[model samples]
Target: MTSADARDAGDAEAFPTVQLDLPVPTNVRVRTAEFVKSSVEISQCPKEGPPEFAVIGRSNVGKSSLINMLTGRKALAQVSKEPGKTQCINHFIINDSWYLVDMPGYGYAKRSKDQRREFDAFTKAYFKQRGTLAMVLLLVDGSIPPQPADLDYAAWLASAGVPFSIVFTKADKKKKGGPRALSNVAAFKRALLEARGFPLVPPSVVTSAATGDGKSELLAFVASLRGMWEAAKKRR
Candidate 1:
């Protein structure tokens, strides 16, 4: 069988549950997922309100692959070999329950100045203004040490008071039986801790689209956040 087929077969079996160390329950399952809409601006996004979790990262960080893996849909989010292909805010409604938003990749040096400015403005506005936004899933390449752009974005999100979680992608790319990915994750966390001058760190997960590692945990994390969002909405 092809590798993709193997990954699919593996997903069919029971996988280990993701331990978030949070009080939220992680029993939720995704029964159905459908592409809802793609919008250039957050204002153009779907009006039917559901708690939305957005995924973003530097260019070519495997954000699309991770999204597809988490939802068990191969082509749901177009996986491109080229970086910066996703220039719009793409929304996928999951089980008619919540929205999975795919935001444009940042830190591509080839992008025009105007394009970068546009993305910056829109991204900042979405984070600052989107009331239904539950959390941001920030994907980072796990095979290498932390990049400055990722660190800067994390700091920016913290300053903006935006809720987010770190997802280390491409774990399968790490050397066989090596701890390079884990070491990178640790270094990134230390940088964040040092930069923020605090002991608390954002929730994080390690993932690989090829082997379906951390798929269950990532989904469980989303499920827990969605539950919290629903409860908060009811209280209001």
Candidate 2:
């Protein structure tokens, strides 16, 4: 057993497990709306009734591939061989129950400073201000150790008190029992603990868009939110 395994065993009951009960691809509604590149455009997010769950990450982190895995629909979102393909806040309404928001990735290359700032401005506004937003799934590349930028972003989210979870993508890239891959993920976990302390952050699930790892668990998390949405609607 690894160090993290021991640690997790010690608190197995403490960590919440995402319920994996929802059927895959029962009914998925995927679509792309306007690409909001500026702050003003983000303000026009649909003021609809369904709660929103936004997926975001740094550039080239496989956000689209992961989305496709979640919906059981290949090519549901634009999967690009190139980076920065998604530059807007894309929304997908699922079973008319929830809205899946795909926000523009931060920190992509080949962009001017002004363009990056615009992206950041729009993302910040969306996360901080979107009324129907229920949670943000912050995708992190698990093939490599967590970077300083990832830690910084997580810290920022915690400081802002935004509800978010860490998703380690590309698990299939790592070979089983490979020392290098294990070390990288361990380092990432250490960095996360150092950056934000242990309990403040949500438990992370390792995933691979290629092998469909963690797909059911992720959907179960979304399904568990059904109660929360019902309560919110009652409040309204």
Candidate 3:
């Protein structure tokens, strides 16, 4: 196996990527955002209901802040200064129609061996078993190049045939022309492209909780996927 392969599955396309790059992205009209519950296991998750879009990433990727910005709520999701502060599957009911899941940070969080094992077991189960899982918003640090933890986990998603999109966070910390973030995004796409099983780049959105940039695009993407998910359910 090559370096990229060993680092990630880079396998062939097992499933078609979702077309989320809509020509005209729609703005998300969030009417209500409410905290529901937190679960540490898949069995404890709420009964199958509305489509769920899970937000996941490494520690300190500003997942909470992003969630707040997206929902137009100041503190719907708890924001923590310490990495890995969240260690449960947090569910937020949005617009009283769908769910926004705040997943625990995977990599770069200091945890005991047992804690890491628990995360690996339950998180993967949630991804594989959750019936209402629509799309996972995979968060990555826009300030730096792709980290191995991010790439490897992305590779796992590809191998598992899970539906997800790349979300570059903290877009406000960039240069005049945003060279650093641009370069980092480019590098991440390139890495995924080179992976064996991975197909073309998945949909990507750059967002900044501070400046509220790319919020519309991200919402539009979510709206598009939500529509698709709903249609699929109807067909079933």
Candidate 4:
């Protein structure tokens, strides 16, 4: 059977529930500021005491929109009509205590083979090498059925041993009880089924940049991870 077919038939019980309290990303508590992008500095992302939550997803998957939603700002990550606009890692200091990293999206574009290759190399390096990345929120398009490329990338992350979770974007665009959302999440599970040594897999959260869904759950998750890291550093 094809991998996707097998996945579509797999049991849901095998996937454990990740506890999360969904919260809206509101402007009242969101004090966001965008910082400059420096690939060199990105290498040292975790050097500081604050924990970093990095967001990565496919090109034009409303990544910038999500960031703006989370920060309660109109245009924090620079929304653009073109794909592959975010060529570098963008950092935002939040509440002067933590950071939100805006990573370049993967898959699809009209770029030449060389540019695509360069992007692949750069993004792979960032995920494999970034030090202070406490949590990586990989955004998924909840408005459509699962794409093969998304599954492949999820498996890649599993194999690479990177910590990450699924964040479904643009849920407002999806019809309630839609097949698209189910397919997208099912695809994610299938990819993760092959992951080794990645115990305690994180939970997937649904969000809408327009409605600000899942904002609280995401922040709480990040805050929890930050605490764990802090405790570990203290022990060292």
lDDT of each: 0.80, 0.71, 0.79, 0.70
**Candidate numbers, best TM-score first, in rank order:** 1, 3, 2, 4
Candidate 3 regions with alpha-carbon error over 4 angstroms? 1-27, 175-182, 195-197
TM-score per candidate? 0.85, 0.80, 0.85, 0.78
Candidate scoring better on TM-score of 2 and 4: 2
Model 4 agreement with the true structure over 1-236: per-residue lDDT tens digits: 75533554463446754554433333225565666454533455445556678788898888888888887888778888798877777778887767788877787568777877777788778777767667778888876766677766766777788877888887677434454344555545644554433343457777888788877766666666666776676897
lDDT of 1 by residue, 1-236 (tens): 85543543453232222234444755467788899888987779888589999998998899888879988999999889889888888999888888888888998788998998899789878888998899999998877777889998988888899988889898788433253233566667766767655356677888999999998888887888877777778899
How do the residues 127-181 of candidate 2 rate in per-residue lDDT, one tens digit apiece? 8888777888899987776677778788888788787878888977853445534
- Model 3, 1-236: lDDT tens digits are 64432332332233244454443433367888999999987878889899999988888898888899999898889898888877899999988988999988886547887887788778778988887899888999877777888898888887887788889998777523343233566667777767544667787887899889888878877887777776677899
lDDT of predicted model 2: 0.71
RMSD of each: 6.8, 5.0, 7.1, 6.2
lDDT at position 215, candidate 1: 88
Where in model 4 is the C-alpha error above 4 Å? 1-14, 17-29, 38-49, 175-183, 190-201
Worst 10 residues of 2 by lDDT: 30-39
**How does candidate 2 fare on TM-score?**
0.80
